[model samples]
Target: MRNFNKNALNGKRAIITGGGGLLGPHHAIALVEAGASVTLVDINEKGLKRAKTKILKVNDSAKIATQILDITNLNAVEKFEALQTKHDTNFDILINNAAVNPKMSEIGGQNSGRIEDYNLNQWNNEINVGLTGAFICSRVFGSRMAEKNKGVIINISSDLAVRAPDQRVYSPSESFDDIKSYKPLGYSVVKTALIGMTRYLAEYWGHKNVRVNALLPGGVFNKQPEELVRNVSKRTLLGRWANLNEYEDAIVFLASDSSAYMTGQSLIMDGGRSVV
Candidate 1:
């Protein structure tokens, strides 16, 4: 049996964007467990509080901080710098996990509509939050990492980054023709762009020892409608949606020294969905 040291990230300082989302808190818990001080940033104040609460529940002694900021704004650069100073961390790791992703329950039922009906404002907003926001965070935070010659960036992408969304998964039946609504094009486009940026930065910063990589995670089970869950589960080789804890180790590995030799890569944890 191989003995893996879970505390491989001792004394590390990490930052996670979109730390208020469904999987964001889980990412924080994983990094905290690995012995890293975490700063969770998000635009949603309530969500940020909830996420921090969850993390505290898991590890009472965990060194955690919460910040509310919009990553796409130019002001984020200053705020990020201030966060590093306030936390007194040189920023050993950055998880670019923020994005405008709507849940299955939010689709059709919420303000979301079909692609043909997707508002121009909505499109630009998603791009700004998902792609441009990532670039802003990377530019401000990653530049410091490059200068220090040490850091890791884990860009959280989706299975759609590689393959187009199976529109059938959103329909009541597995029929594409009868689709009443569809996953917005902006979501897939932004995620794919992140992968490209990941590769570009990996090479751009390789000489500086600032490793960059992307994690393509599949749909996580988050109390969505049963039919939608079943639809996606059948499409996946794993036969079920991913539990929140499933990707913890992968996130930790990418953030820690475990992936020291790896960069410019997309680690797909979609339960073989991309192959099919």
Candidate 2:
């Protein structure tokens, strides 16, 4: 039996895309706690500042860096990669976590919840940020990892990747016709596509000792409306949504040698929502 060291990532470096979002800082904190230096990449400069502040508040000595870059632009990403190389910073882990998720509050009116009314621009934007961005980052960062013959790539998918969104949860009232919001088609499509990407990359980089996988996390409770929370809770076996930091340990496990033998797999961390 091999002994698992909690500090297995002591000197490892990681790069997390979408590092300015709600969960991005949490993921960075987890890695830093496990002894890894982290660089967070996102287009939202303000959000990146907030994420860094949040992480530093937890651990003043945490090794965290933030960069504002559009992941959809291949040239931009390549430039960022060149800069990191110039600094002699080779990332040992890459977390494809950046995405544009449309909330219920952001939907309705011209942005109708109905599929037929979905705007083309919205679809393209979401797909570009959530899907294309992931591809570009993997191409730039993962390829470098392959050159070194060791790395891990984790695609942050959603539980919706495995199961379709239960549209009822978006309904403001008990009546089905009262659905004021929806989980956009692009959201699910992007997440589902990530699964396929994970499989392909895992195999493509396996010989190079680069392991790739996806983390399909369920909804996190973030001050959503009471009714929405109730509806989502009813569908989940755990009877509630996940807390903000719930996925941190899983992120650390995937990024570290703890999951050494795991590859090309989707690790679903929904509150048993998919099962029920």
Candidate 3:
């Protein structure tokens, strides 16, 4: 339950990709509470249901919608835009938050193995979901926003976008010959490229009043192993990972008029992990 400024986003509409993930619904709730209509899009239908239920508990009357969408597919994205039109919902914000993220302990299983042994299929899947997906959504949805000459696109990146993953944090005493748990190359590369996309789109659409920005958030606390938590805490200047709702206000700022003068920038809320 957050005390949001009721008029902050009055009459606005937002679309959040990866809306079924850990942080997406929180962003949706924050915006909805502030008087925006939000449509949650994700590939996971069950996750979408849970996310919608969670948001409804916060704002029972919130104008909410959901679509089982695969953002990686351009055709699917087009179909979603058509559906929104049928519903008379012309969105003003897009949150690119979908990515292939796995826990440190589960890294090896998620294709975070020694580079030489990394599976190309896994690498392609990561890129398609994290990078290509953003491109497709932006091309289809963002172009519409540009035509309207007023909109905001909030790209959800990560602290790893600005700083390389601390591989040491994923340390496990596995044999050199065995599949090691190194951070996947795709995660950092795709996240970093998102910032690049933000800058380019900001300039490309600035004249049309379409502002583009990115959020480079640190790890969120979600009961990871104690060892991993302690390691991350020691590395962060704030001495802890971010609370799940810590970035809510930041997300709202980026999605609303509060950041009217901001564009082509990234809001780094990483507990100072990149500093020291």
- Local distance difference test, each candidate: 0.87, 0.90, 0.87
Residue 179 error, candidate 2, Å: 0.9
Candidate 1, residue 200: Cα displacement in angstroms equals 0.5
TM-score of each: 0.95, 0.97, 0.94
Task: Encode model 2's per-residue lDDT on 1-276: one tens digit a residue.
Answer: 113355878999999999999989988988888889999999899999999999999889999999998999999999999998999898999999999987676678877757878888989999999999999999999999999999999999999898989888888665668787777899999999999999999999999999999999999999888998999999999999999888888888888878999999999999999986
Candidate 3 ranges with C-alpha deviation above 4 Å: 1-4, 172-180
Which one wins by TM-score: 2 or 3? 2
Ranking of predictions according to TM-score: 2, 1, 3
**Runs of candidate 2 exceeding 4 Å displacement:** 1-6
Identify the candidate with maximal lDDT: 2
- Any runs in candidate 1 off by more than 4 Å, and if so which? 1-4, 82-88, 109-112
- Model 1, residue pairs in steric clash: none
Q: What is the lDDT for 55 in model 2?
A: 94
- The per-prediction tally of clashing pairs is 0, 0, 0
lDDT of 3 by residue, 216-275 (tens): 999999988786788789899999999988888888889888899999999999999999
